[model samples]
Target: MSDPNANRGLAGIVAAESALSFIDGAEGRLSYRGYDIHALARHAGYLEAVYLLWYDALPSAMELAVFEGTLAGQRELPAAVLEVLGRLPDASTPMAALRTAVSVLGQVDPEAEDISHEADLRKAGRLVAQLPTVIASFDRIRRGLEPVAPDPELGHAANFLFMRTGQAPGPTAARALDTSLLLYLEHGLNASTFTARVVASTLADIHSAVTAAVSALKGPLHGGANEKAMEMLLDIGSTEAAASYVDKALAEKRKIMGFGHRVYRTEDPRATHLRRLAEELSVESADTRWFELSRAVERLMLERKGLHCNVDFYCATVYHALDLPVDLFTPLFAMGRTAGWAAHVMEQHMHNRLIRPRAEYTGELDRPWVPIDRR
Candidate 1:
């Protein structure tokens, strides 16, 4: 048998090839479409980065205006999709609801299977355009509230917040949401993006590939960690409680949610930016309760596990302050990640590999058949 440690956790696995983002986990660095994540978070809006992810460069002035116009154009779902949204149970999870809606979208736009570059770009535009609508609609439906109409005057992030809350978000909340979306836009070969590429490699339709990705990303380890981080903080209750919780969790060898990452050994680059957003939102509100709880957990996790929070840690509090539902956190993740997935899909199709990998076999060798009585 091969050495067990030979592939510990599949660490350093080169899952796919792409001209997308590169993550230096050891250095806590991330870049998208060749721009540092810090710069993008500081300056760029979410849709701009999405354009870059798919098109390989930032848009020109006229291109930016045109792209924004296109996104504004497709903000409403067809009546059929809204009907499905109406039937979803109020208790349904957002990822499940989103997965269902994504499949249902195939029925609404039956032409989404067109794979030529021009055709794919059109579908990409539609998906990007409709994502906010789907998310906002699901948000209200699950909360027993009616979905609000989209406002074309608002930017992407502002429109999303406005649609969810029935009022305009302040500049600070809107910017934070925009940065959060940019931060979530891409990472190097994450599970869901890889899943999308795998399906795309098989020559499936883009909708089918994306649908596969949504299913893969539903796992707590992949996209649900942010919601889990919030739950952990509420369960901890206080700074004093945090210490005890850390002690017991460490003694039992249990993972503290949001404490460790598969890629980063020192810190998560995305966490740095999200931490700033959490602090900024706290400053804007002058309420530090959630921030303090998060800090306590961070301190305890580092002291106990020598690990730091990933993007999901402080983001929980940010979303909480925004009054977002816990279940929707991961779907929000998908809304942002769709950009990266689209980019990777284009890359996979252009450079066309089958993506077939061999498993290291360690099973019973071939043997002659025996009668049941002899066995």
Candidate 2:
């Protein structure tokens, strides 16, 4: 029994006006700043997507080139930040490590206290540039391997992969990852984006707002869904088992990871692109197991439950085909989402307002307490 009158999760409430991204969940479409997401995911580079989200317009060719140089220039992490990453316990989750690393980055940044639009924009670019480095370095460090330095000549996705394995990614792999990052560039008022806006509403620095976003994304119902979804795929093991697993999981009243979204009434528009990318990568690697199994589950879920795959569904297989660890999936999410988080933070700062929502009281309205002697 629930109160029908109450807006239980603030599900339908419009919190603010934003021009960053738009979603027509009923139509299964998404766009950022008037650009179709399908177009961006298919053709735009991640850096280009970052520029679009931040600048409110698609950059001209020369602008994109200069933007690339500017963001790529900031890819190196502070040495103290590197030291912190190196000392974090091997058991540290990428999400936790990244959150801590971002906080440290703020302390080292001289402009961290500056919340002006110009300073925030610069900080945003720096964060987006450094996120992959932080995650890749942490991965290599925890594995007792020397971190490979960032390659300035490499594109964002390729540089991230290169920094991890000390090998430049091939065109196809790099494009797949770039497309995935572009697809994740923005979504309308998602948990992490909302968290970022809320913190920014208080006039917090970009780094502090982003750190809070990373923390919000650590929750399983949010960014961690892809990691859990991938683990579920691993547990299912093969295509033959996917249907039975889904059926059994449903019958037993268990939650299926990556099957639905909070906002989308139809399929997640981004999932379609990811499904294609996953298949391409799996075929390229001659490892079609995860991709095939993902399709099996996807079809079965649609047939049985009428639910659609969110952006995170096929993304599990896509990341696996790219050789990313399950645990790194969420941080990779945080990495891609940095663009949107920063954009939202800047937007909130531009229109400064503290986001204080009221809560309804459900307990007894009046109660009396006696003194200790009244026992």
Give per-model CA RMSD. 1.8, 1.5
Score candidate 2 by lDDT.
0.91
Candidate number with greatest TM-score: 2
TM-scores of the models, in the given order? 0.95, 0.97
Error of 1 at 172 (Å): 0.7
lDDT of 2 by residue, 1-375 (tens): 358577877898999889999899899989989999888887888889889889888899999999999888999999999999988887899899999999999999879899999999999989998999999999999888998889989999999999999989899899988888888888989888899999999898999999999999999898999999999999999999888899999999888899888889898999999999999998888888889899999999899999998999888888898899899999989999998999999999999889989777667856788799996
Model 1 alpha-carbon miss at residue 61, Å: 2.9
Task: After the best TM-score superposition of candidate 1, give how far the Cα of residue 153 lies from its true spot, in angstroms.
Answer: 1.1
